[model samples]
Target: DVEKELEVQIGMKQEMELAMQMLEKDICDKQDVLVTFRQQLDDVQSLNHELSQKVQGSDNVIRQKNEIIARLEEKASQMNCTIKQLEQRLRQTQSSCQSAEEANYLFKQEFGEKILRLQNEVDLLTKQRSQLEMGLKDKKLSLHSDPHRINGSEQVKADQQQMADMKKELEQLREENLRLRQAGEESPSNGIHQSSRSSAEAEKERSTLERQNVICKLCEEEVSVTRLKRRCHNCQAIFCSQCAINELPLPSSIQPVCVCNPCHRVLLQQYSTTPPP
Candidate 1:
């Protein structure tokens, strides 16, 4: 009986020990599972925080993009308004240009007639001036031949004064003709193309006048058309370079200047009598 009881007690003690070991193992496994769960929770929380920051940054970027879009829209609106204003101004300018063209055409027609009449008068006056100059030359020659002719001296003086008045009138008429012709040809209200065309016509007129009317005053060599580029600085008469080759000093000039033969001779005589101060 005592032996059986001892065996039963040992078995019971072993079983209890084994059961307690199993319970402790189960407890350790539970604690490990809990720790794993806690670690996983911590990882989840960190990931959530990072995701929150990214979302916030994304939101800020989206807001900035919206602001930029709004500003761009405002700029576009302002640009459209400016374009409208420019278009309106362009239309007004085009209309004004058309009206100006019509007015300019009418003005040219009226001034054309006036300019033609003035040109005819200038030609008549020029012929009259030549006759008067010839008459004066004849009178001067008669006086030189008969030095005692005091009676013709007063008449010569009167004729000279009349010639001077006629010359002044002729110069006035020429100026008026030039002004009327310029007005007929050129207008400030004209377009740039019109202005350029007018300038070309003026150049053509200048060339024609040079060809028809302007002859070398000194060269007298009558070969119909000679290019007259040089003008006498003293007498302002157009001449060839060979005709006015001499240089002389004048009171108005800082240096020696090219003068016509007649002007140069007069300057020489004056200098001989009274030297430059």
Candidate 2:
């Protein structure tokens, strides 16, 4: 019986050895699978890093494009403002040129009228001078023919006085003619410069000179000087009171500030068409 028990124990030992061998083989297969999984995980991590770098580069390119667009928009706006300013300046220049042309035309018309009026006055004066000369010749002939009948007669004395007064008037008229000729011969630039004086300043100077008994510029006749008399605001020349009343009449609104016919015409033209400031 003891022999039989020993045989059974030996058989059990052999079965246990076989089971241990099978467990060792299964453990070796599982280790191989774990190594393959670890390699795959490392590859995935490398790919993810490369993708992140590409995304950052794309973001930088987009940011640069946005900045360039903003700069182009700002430059366009500046160019628009500059173009508008240039257009406005061009319009202003055109307006100024038109105004200057109108002023030049008016000045020419006024100058032509003045020349015509002066010519007429000269012709009238010449006719009057000739008539006076003929009257003096007739008077001289009568005086020589009746020498004895002159000194004692009142009519003879009156005739002599009248002759002296006429001679003096003729001399005065000649002087006035010479002066007019000189004034007409002056340069246009000089005349323009003289005319540019402010009217208010001219009036002030004229008033101050009136107190000093200023001579009449046209007729050369001495008279009481006042603002009521005819005066040229341009040349600041006083005219004889008798001539002023007959020849140059002042506007009611501009009373006591009488301008000559030439000056009055200029003022009328300047005020009529000039645009309001």
Query: How do the predictions measure up, each by TM-score?
Result: 0.54, 0.31
Score candidate 2 by TM-score against the native.
Answer: 0.31
lDDT for 214 (candidate 1): 47
**lDDT of model 2 at residue 106?**
49
- Minimum summed lDDT over a 10-residue window in model 2 is located at 246-255
lDDT of 2 by residue, 1-277 (tens): 8788888877787777877788777788878887887888788888888888988998998999999999988998998999999989889866765664454444435444553444346445544644655665676667678777655345545655665665566456545544543443342312222123478986886566555655666556565733234566455667644333222212322112445544544554554454533
Instruction: Locate the minimum summed-lDDT window of 10 residues in model 1.
Output: 188-197
Q: How many residue pairs clash in all the candidates, one count each?
A: 0, 0
37: Cα error in model 2, Å: 2.5
Write down the RMSD of all candidates, one decimal each: 15.5, 14.3
Candidate 2's displacement at residue 47, Å, is 1.3
Model 1, residue 178: C-alpha shift (Å): 8.3
